[model samples]
Target: MVAGRNVLRALRDIRSFRVVVLHPADAESDELVAQIRRIGCRVELIWPPRDGIPDSTDIAFLLFRQDALTDAILRSLEDRPLAVTLIAIVEAESPTVIEAVVRSGASAVITKPIRAFGLLTSMVLAHKFSTGKLISAEKMSRLQTRLSGARVLEQAKAIVMSQRGVTEPEAYALIRERAMANRSSIEAICASIVSTGDVPGR
Candidate 1:
């Protein structure tokens, strides 16, 4: 019962999503749009491939044709800061097609003939995968920033030790005191100390 409620809630939430279909007008594209609309998502269809996704797009279904591939389509696949989930549509399982799908960074794939059977599953999984990737990226960025601040803090401590002939603990204390006095972060004080080669308000 709980799982069913969660599934229903998820479906309801998907109604607010804005989906973009980057495929030429045809039976397949029409079917895709119809199915997505039936699922209660707002759908927009575009052809000939634009250089970028629209700012309002929350999810995008991109058709990849081996022979019809263009620079504009590839540019559209380039990394953007938007939280858009990408689904690749392909007609073949050839190596070239697989390569294109990989390059597009699609989290899920829909094969030709566009059946409604797996469409919702693909959308849900792709969105979950994209959201996970974003969370992981944000965590990595935070870790990197902390590592950078550690390096700067250590460098600042070393400079203080050399300049004042104090021990490491004393140097750290000095830095904390300076940070508090300036109403700033220890990392900010450390950064300024390292960059200017002198402690502030000394």
Candidate 2:
């Protein structure tokens, strides 16, 4: 599935990537921006991030390592509605910071010092996904699986909350109830419910 997803993604249009390089330089900002422009795909140069994200810059990169993202930066990008943040970091960053970034909805991380090819590839792949390219049988299958799982989890949790008097998040209780009743593992029970629409005592 992963291979087929990559194959479909690889066939997408690479030209659609629009990158925003943030945390700008003073006198050097325009110079670096000019150099980035010469690299020849759409690139936006911004600082302070307060004026709001330019509409075309779908993928944003923090060219330097920030221990934690500032609320201002988050606010600026959030205004874009569909913007995806790309963070660049070295390999030794603390897992906590990485977790924060992921939890905050970052799309991907690029480890620096970056190769031009790898950067370009990441940009193209992100843009393709952002542009709604679900190009392979495997990707389609995986997407269906994800949607099915989400639906099943929601319904199962609702069932548990209704019948057993538990909170909506008792994923464990929902699984346990379905599993014990059906004589199956929680994983298998959830999979059955998701894929085959089976629910015990419904």
Find the candidate with the highest lDDT and give its number. Answer: 1
Q: Backbone clashes in each candidate structure, one number apiece? A: 0, 0
* Lowest summed lDDT window (length 10), candidate 2: 83-92
lDDT to native, each model: 0.87, 0.58
* lDDT score, candidate 2, position 15: 40
Candidate 1 residues 21-138, lDDT tens each? 9888999899999999998899999886555678778899988777755345766568665479999998878888899888878899999988999888888888878988999989
Stretches off by above 4 angstroms in model 2 are 1-12, 26-39, 63-69, 83-92, 131-202
On a 0 to 1 TM-score scale, where does candidate 2 land against the true structure?
0.46
Residue 41 deviation, candidate 1, in Å?
0.2
Q: Pairs clashing in candidate 1?
A: none
The runs of at least 3 residues in candidate 1 whose Cα sits more than 4 Å from the true structure, single-residue gaps closed, are 1-6, 68-71
Candidate 2 per-residue lDDT, tens place, 1-202, comes to 9988876555443345566777556544454445445555577776656666677665676643344345456545554655454544334466655655664456566664344545555655555565463245457888998887777667656655665676766755767876888788765776665555545655
